[model samples]
Target: MKPFRRRSLLAAGFSAILSVQHVLAIQLDLQSTDSIKAAAKTLAGDMVSYYTGYRPGDVPGNLPSPYYWWEAGAMFGALVDYWYFTGDDTYNAITTQALLHQVGPDKDFMPPNQTKTEGNDDQAFWAMAALSAAENKFPDPPEDQPQWLALAQAVFNTQAARWDTTSCGGGLKWQIFAFNTGYNYKNTISNGCFFNMASRLAVYTGNQTYADWAVRMWDWCSAIGLRDAQYNFFDGSDDNLNCSQLDHIQWTYNAGTFLVGAANMYNFTGGSQEWADRLNGIIGNLKLFLKNNVVYEQACEPVGTCNVDQRSFKAYLARWMAATAVKAPFTYSLLKPILEASATAAAAVCTGGVNGTSCGLKWTEGTFDGSIGVGEQMSALEVIQSNLIDIVSGPVSQDSGGTSKGDPNAGTSSDIGPSDLNVGEVTTADKAGAAILTVLLIFFVAGGAWWMVT
Candidate 1:
């Protein structure tokens, strides 16, 4: 960056533009990340400030009124990541408040006594967030504050009692109530989230029982075609009770939960090629959440419409996909470019409201069409936050054909996966200059979205 080197970058041909582009790219990346960082902090603040409350349906950044258990749980998961990425205390405070209100007298998260909606899957979502907070060492509020790990454990215990082997070779049913629509359905979200939670708990507590459960869940899910050979995750099997039919609809969160579990299994015990392959396979199909390589909900988007749960799905996918990078660094090279490409696309879609900054469901980069809400805000916040993780972890190489050796201390990781909820610094490989540049150009085009918001 000396004067001569700077001038040398500015020659008059296509070569010159390409030569100087790298220099410009550096400034642009910093701007983009800065914008992302600032936006994550502010939007998170806005969500908590405006939407969440003592009522059942009040969690900000969730779709559908009167509070849905899983959606609120999903929002808390993102809040946990925001805490780790930026050390923002507000997210922590809100999370504590939300949990305090939601965790009922029995320590099950009933949420304002909305017991009818308390599916095991819905309840486990809260536990997953608490486990994440516990892993990160988020301070307990007071002695009065529920212990995070204890809350998560309680959730697991609740699910364990419901495991029915009588049908479909054993998977947790979607609903706790026998008469509910999904009651007989052994769905992927319930089983998948349980798999992820079991994997984390196996590492955290060094309990073979938890590890065994993780293994069991993985086997059942794979055998049932919920987590299939193609790495294409299907929605849960319907309530025919036979488990022979698969729903086949895919969601961002399904991949998120299953891949994170696979990555955790790889990290915790090592030499699980099956697990390693599963992780790679899912990473390969991440375009399920992307459009032209930029991440999208893939279910309801570009039409600028998404249903209650679908609107909030991408945040979990983005959050845990970043986690997968940490849990299996060997895959870092594979994950980085896709994530950066998507983040850059996300930055572009956020525009033309709130000081030229509005978040919309459609990620296909055009000016924002004036639709804005909590779910849109969070979808943008989570993706941008992952981009920040990319910058910190630095350049990553795709892990090639070599077998995964895993962590040297797989035994220790088996007991305590990762460092306090950290993704750890992913090692760099050869830089993907073009990919990074593509990201920067999109951010440059959408530069005002970030800058004008503040």
Candidate 2:
């Protein structure tokens, strides 16, 4: 069948499977169309309240209490993804506003006084969202707004300088500066983010340098054993720079971030066999994260102990699976079962809105676990939006509705809020309060067994 004919038929036939496709999606792409549609409906309804905590007008520095730049960045990245996947412009402002608030004068992302909290990894997280904005042309900012593409490039430039070739055959460090203990740490996330960003930038710029960086980052990651033969990514080896002594810990995002990078490199290389092998190997390794075909934070949460960060990790894995699935038809069919189950179950976990419409963590249980917070809401949003990508782009003959030619990311775009508003100018008292709040995050990062381990 021709592409449009297939898409049109799929569009009309889309209604055929909503209530019944979950079981059949494992066998066919047409069946999963309904699953994605069904999942998108629930996400559209809850997105407003789910994002209420992160808006700029309401909170100090325009962030909710227990502010985390990295998590907020990921949340915004997911929202931009939703906009691109569905062309729903309602989310455009929120994603733009929140991100603009963080882009300082340097084009580097640090939300003002919270500099102590963000490392190279944290900044990369925010930059990841910016890159998504650049790739998809989510929305053009209004006149007198930050140029999303330039901001993303500024981030890449900063990261490129920090790519330490001296360390274990070359990779990025966990911290951008030396003040913190993580400065020398060559972790999966820092380099994974670099790999992902570089891969994406290569596609956006048609720049061979970006492509080279992507290849180099992945090679180093594998050489260091951070990405092992099985393609599973371990947590960072602490500050040694030797790239030996793989920490051997696992997290959904560590492995997940690398997959998208690999996929992009595959696409950029015009489907090179080397990148293809890496993509397939990475996907095969991700099987360890599944339970009965549903994705989970496998190493944690089964014992009722997913900490602040781990609770949200699987969302990224779901996201990249759908993002790259458009390029890998085989991987799409293989991965859609988990996406379908995750979207349905994740939607069913909501129970805390004005009348029980919000979502919570522990989505696999299909019901709220008596907890409600920003991280859980962010996680659910990521996967729910993820399903939309699969619906429009996965395993079907359609132009990638989510992206286009020549990186249509020129000119400055406006924001939803005041452009000049800084993130936080903390007073002594606010610093004290933020200090207490930062403890939970610090403990969370230090692995109260939280192996999303940055």
Candidate 3:
């Protein structure tokens, strides 16, 4: 069937799933995974519609003019989770193609075209997508293509090399190149991503080096006050000021990144109390983003000033927190109600847009706030599908059935393409088509052993 026809049918069929009283909203029966999957299918379909990158005359790894290259990476990551949780392969082919096409010459996601604007965080998001692919056991790429584990490790290796020690003691600068805006700042998202990636890599590959890097990043963040006494992770600090002052803005993704990273560390150390305290601290502080149990962009939602990028912050937090529940196990009870409430609110706000099911940025409103974008749709999709967290098995590692190959020295090469090109400019649009693991953990659940370790 044609795309429009499928959307129309899906929109028309929403009535059967929605509650009669809340007919204007997409109401989900959170207790039922089938109901959750149905809602997720609708949200994911709507979310992927915003992408034009896969079409003729478009860049394969990009969304459009307004959406940045990094978000496209993040969206694909969410879709990977969508497939993992719901068993929907609807978006897999396109997702695979998009991921492979953007691997760049070095396969570190530093595609030559994106070097102008790519930051540590931007590249890390794409690496996170590859990380998600490895963890979720998404179908591996063809033997000739870049494997998922290698791609993630390449990114880790390159970024690990970029961890600057000259300023603020140690941390990654916001941007990769000195000319890019925000280059003088060192942000939590950038370093938190590294920490998250490293912790998971350690769990997956059983590498002490990656775990050491994870601990170092966490300590640097804390020592520099990016993570405050209350464990509230602020935004970036100015390296020009010698890291004396922070941006003080608390974005959900910042906390979410560190949250999962801490969870993995907690799991990696065999449930150490130190990591547990850090996990609980971050989780407690995250309540600042919650309003009556639903997740909201507290930094910008109330002011009606959320920019395009800020709008998608909730998606990462929702997904990361859900991942934390699985990785840590102990946090499941604490995280569940918040996620469930947010998912319901997210669905309720899907009453907007042409199809009357497009999500909005503010879930606190309890109604569609007339906002719509890839971010809104993605936030809704992730939160809805994450309801499957408990039912579905958690991520896998090489010790388990994971099949993605790794390269410890992957991104250490000095042969990456030049860094002067336009952010999303694809030189040869003709060759667009292509194709595209963590850890062992042992948890004691109710006096019984929960074997997350393969």
Candidate 4:
């Protein structure tokens, strides 16, 4: 009886393991274009299912609660790539409408509704989406609507004006408005977005000035230790501490952001060794986020501590890595296999939810992690569609039959006046006067606080 029971227990355990291992339901034949497009289409459709932004009474460009505005912009950006790669026009109309509606009066991404909650990083995500549209030659808006390249330039101009030398020597603040919680923090994402846009714009317009800004932003980030000697990009630092120490938590999106920007610089410089070295430095350290060649959120995925935002980070990494391959073809051999492994793993976990294909956060497990949302879906869609990278047409520039228009000074308001703007030039007297004004302001604030206490 004891011998029979032991054999039965072993059989049951084997059967249980087999049952939990989900079959690969997403049929992706990487070798065949038809097969790849079909798989990506289904995944994109499934992703769009969670988006209620276009529904009656819902805001057009904003994802529902728990998902932030920046992500919705990102989703549209992914859909633009989807259309570019797969020729699927299913999501284009709504994508265009959402983008146009959110351009705000300044033509930058800072809509009035998001003023209280929007950070510099938040606005940059939207600008990046618009830039993607221009690069992909996504259909231009009707003649009256804001042009895609101009919108991106507007964001670049506004952010350039906000570069804060007051804290951490130099870097953009995390938040746009003073009342926001992270206003005092200088973050990699904000600065990286600026760098990314600058590099891409440099490539698109053949503009030396944009390239210079890209170099400046990269130098500033490295000097400040946001990027360490090992190429591990840390999160952000407290301006209160003068950025002496970083947050030290590495996020996949931060690394991805810098990687794509560096790749673009490589293309802009006609394959400069400096940018090539930077790219290698970044990818060398990126292995920490990959498990079995599959991309996962390193910081929070393992511990199951990823909040709503962190869950979607791998999507950016996957998409940007694909872009990096296009900008610098040498990276294709390195990034392609990783992208293929990740896409396959990402597709396998889509066996959850009522549709039997809701994506989960962890792609390495090959089974649904039981989580579902816009992030998971976006991650899946990006990795899966990105498999078509090598076959699709690469991005174009103004010199290469591109048609998107741009304005160098799109977002600068005339009302601010030249004297108030410190971006261009400042004499010694200007610095001395600013220092005196700052001292007087501090004294008055202290005096006001003392009076209130008394």
Clashing residue pair totals per candidate (backbone < 3 A)? 6, 5, 4, 0
Per-residue lDDT of candidate 4, residues 1-454 (tens digit): 6999999999999776545444435777788889889878878888888787565445567777888888888889889999999988999987887888778767888766675577889988999999999999998877777899999999888888887888787888887766567777899999998999999999999999899999999999999999988998999999999999789999999999999999999999999999999999998888989999999997888889999988888889988999999999998898999899998898888877766677889998878889998899889989989999978889988899678888888987721222343343446786577667645743554334233222
Which candidate achieves the best lDDT against the true structure? 3
Q: Cα RMSDs of all predictions?
A: 16.5, 13.0, 11.0, 11.0
lDDT of 3 by residue, 391-418 (tens): 8877999898788899999998843222
TM-score of each: 0.75, 0.76, 0.87, 0.86
Model 3 lDDT, residue 278, Cα: 93
Q: How far off is residue 244 in model 3, in Å?
A: 1.1
- Candidate 4 lDDT trough over 10 residues, lowest sum: 414-423
Candidate 2, 386-417: lDDT as tens digits: 66664443321113342322322321232211
- Candidate 2 overall Cα lDDT vs. reference? 0.66
Query: Each candidate: what lDDT?
Result: 0.67, 0.66, 0.85, 0.84
The ten-residue window of minimal lDDT in model 2 covers 445-454
lDDT of 1 by residue, 1-454 (tens): 7988776666546465444433322111434657667767766764554353433334322334644767777777778778767666776755676665566656656443344466778888888887777665666545644667767777776676667776888888887655345666888989999999888777666567878899999898988889878888888886475888998988888998888888888877863787788788998888767777677777667555577668778778877777788878888788767667766666566653434455666766644545566666677778778767755532111132211111212222122111221222223431255356535643453233222211
Stretches of candidate 4 exceeding 4 Å from the true structure = 1-24, 414-454
Candidate 2 regions exceeding 4 Å error are 1-62, 352-354, 390-454
Could you tell me which residue pairs clash in candidate 3?
134-437, 135-437, 141-436, 203-439
Least well predicted 10-residue stretch by lDDT in candidate 1:
413-422
